[model samples]
Target: MASFVMKQMVGGKLNEMKGGLDSLTGGNEGEGEKTETGEDPEVVAARLEQEERRKDKHRKMEQEREKMRQGIRDKYNIQKKDESGGMGGFDMADGRIGAARKKTPEELAAEMHAEDDSLVGQLGLTEHVEKAKTAVNGAFEMVKGFLPFGK
Candidate 1:
């Protein structure tokens, strides 16, 4: 889903670039710069496309953040939409909630460690994702090994 949104954003930007290039070349680029409302055609299209891309990016970020928030809530046995309301934003942060609830550092540490073990065991990730993660991580480490810091 995120990838689809990203692709849409990239495609939209490419189209906008092409439009701008054609506009720069000549006023005879078919659409000219006149709108039905007597407004600038190029400006209207550019504005509309920018708005669409902005909305798309916002929706994508919300979805990705919600997924992460729900994952954390699941680990801590919390509700997705409890009586207090949806904790989709910063209110569900681990450190903030931990402090408010009086969870000690050592206790939080243990919980985090246990959560890590269960997460890898129960995430239900596909074999393809696991393989891709391995490949990506290996690539990352290979680059890191060649860093100027001489690790």
Candidate 2:
């Protein structure tokens, strides 16, 4: 009984080692184990061809869109920016023309202030507001000058 158990254990270990070695050597075990979907090779090729055709169709549509955009630009006499260099209206990365760049904080603040000033001007209080701002600034400067520590 002991000899039989030892033989079985040794046989199992040998079989495991053989499988490992076969795998390391790129054995044909994978080929035989592959599950076939029963689809014909010709059908697979047709599917791939169809996918290629769909991709081509999308590419052509995108090209047509670009052509339409170009036609509109030509009508308006707008030149597209060169991809290499120049600050023209076209965005090189996205291929979009006249794309607005993001404004910095200072720019946003300046725009807000300009809008406020325009609103104030529309209300006919521009001169009065300017005079008030000047008076306040002059008062601030006069006080600053009187402070000896600032000098």
Candidate 3:
């Protein structure tokens, strides 16, 4: 039956594995002829090639990372300075740490509102439209105030 054929196949595979082990261990298991005591020349050469390839791959990766960092620095117009200096080098124009002055809260809010207004303008919503919406809401509140059960 199929079971008998499967068992035969498994036994053949086990014998092959045992023979390979015997050859690798200088035939101490008596399943194959003995090999030389010295290391296999082919295996040693393969290991040396693998080690050289790994070192080359790591060197390439480091080079690529440094290139990416340099590109980012160039794109942002950043200047590199020595870290041993007492005062860190900063781009004052870009507000990088050593800027002349900081903005007040009101200035910051104004800047945010300008950004919002620009976004609204981009979305086709004009300032007059916003004013009309406010007026409509105010009229609705005034009407509700006249009704006793408005609350």
Which candidate has the top score in lDDT? 2
Better of 1 and 3 by lDDT: 3
Q: In model 1, where do residues sit more than 4 Å from their true spots?
A: 1-33, 36-38, 82-151
Per-residue lDDT tens digits of candidate 1, residues 1-151? Answer: 9999999999999999988987898755555556688777777889999999999999999999999998999899986566464243334556565234446799888985676456464675445566999999999999989998749
Q: What tens digits encode model 2's per-residue C-alpha lDDT throughout 33-86? A: 433765656677888999999999999999999999999999999988766764
For candidate 1, the per-residue lDDT at 24 reads 94
- What lDDT does each candidate get? 0.77, 0.81, 0.78
User: Which candidate achieves the best TM-score against the true structure?
Assistant: 1
Mark the regions of model 2 whose C-alpha exceeds 4 Å error after superposition. 1-39, 85-151
List TM-score per model, in order.
0.32, 0.31, 0.31
TM match of model 2 to true structure: 0.31
Model 1 scores a TM of: 0.32
Residue 4, candidate 2: Cα error in Å is 45
Off by over 4 Å in 3: 1-38, 81-151
Ordered by lDDT, highest first, the candidates read: 2, 3, 1
